[model samples]
Target: MTERAYFDELYASSPDPWDLAARAYELRKYDLTVASLPRARYRRAFEPGCSVGLLTRLLVERCDEVVASDLVAAPLVLAAERAPAATFRRGGVPDDWPPGRLDLVVLSELLYYLSAADRAATIERARESLDPGGHLVAVHWRHPFVEAACDGDTAHAEIRRDPTWRVLVEHVEPDFRLEVLERGAD
Candidate 1:
């Protein structure tokens, strides 16, 4: 897991460490993630690691209610300002999942930051939180990076290994990977 202090120090250095709002790469990636959602509208959604809320704003358009969370408080504050319609909170995954069934859960650019165990826990928690036939979307940069515990390809591979999810859509590019998974109906 990326330590909370690390995230806090990062935010202290610069308000937007990832430059999610200014870069075209980020903008285009967010567009792809939003475009790839299988459902046109969702009753409720959860977004973990919502840095600066750039994508949260777009998610608001597709979801009636969204709970966007981060480990550190500073970015979440910014996220609240950016998308007041969405609920912004400071919490980590696996432990911070909102109560009740969720129709959409977004894991964009988050898994790689977690330890392997935490990553698995987050996936498990996400699956458990989804309502029947609900969707889970994940988008991550494909390239290896120093800060990431695993590469994006490995993260997606881990998700694909689960037997309960069915792929609804997949978009792969040189820069990133995106997958939409639906909870199988019993």
Candidate 2:
């Protein structure tokens, strides 16, 4: 998993380390992500690694409630300011996994940074926490980066290998990959 200090330093330097708010690519990707939701409205959603909460702002429109978290404090502060409707927490995957049933779980630009064990645990937690027919949306940049433990494709492939999730939507581009999976009913 990526260190907390890496994120701390990154957020210390810039509020939006990835230029998520300023980039057209990120804007379009966020739009596509919400558009791909299998359900028109979600009862509750959890978004881990919600940097600056740009996507969390969009998620609030479709979800009755959104709980968003990140490892760093700086972005969480900015995220709360940007998306006041959504609840912001200082946390990350596996260790800080939320409780209760979720109608939607979004892993955006997050999985690749996790170690294999952490990634599997994160996926398991999402699977266990989601209600029947709940959705798990994962979108990642399809490129290699120094900080990433694995490439985006590899991270996504790990999820796709699971038999319990039924694929609902798939969108792939040269720059990124997105998928929505539905949990089986109880």
Tens-place lDDT per residue, model 1, 16-72, is: 998889999999999989999877899999999998999999999999999999998
- 1: Cα error in model 2, Å: 1.8
Candidate 1 deviant stretches above 4 angstroms: none
Q: How do all models score by TM-score? A: 0.97, 0.98
On residues 1-186, what C-alpha lDDT tens digit does candidate 2 reach at each position? 789899999988988988999999999999999999978899999999999999999999999999999988788888898899999888878889777789899999999889999999999899989998899999999999999999888998999898889999999999899999998875
List runs of model 2 lying over 4 Å from the truth. none
lDDT of 1 at 26: 93
Worst 10 residues of 2 by lDDT: 92-101
Give candidate 2's whole-model lDDT.
Answer: 0.92
Number of the top lDDT candidate: 2
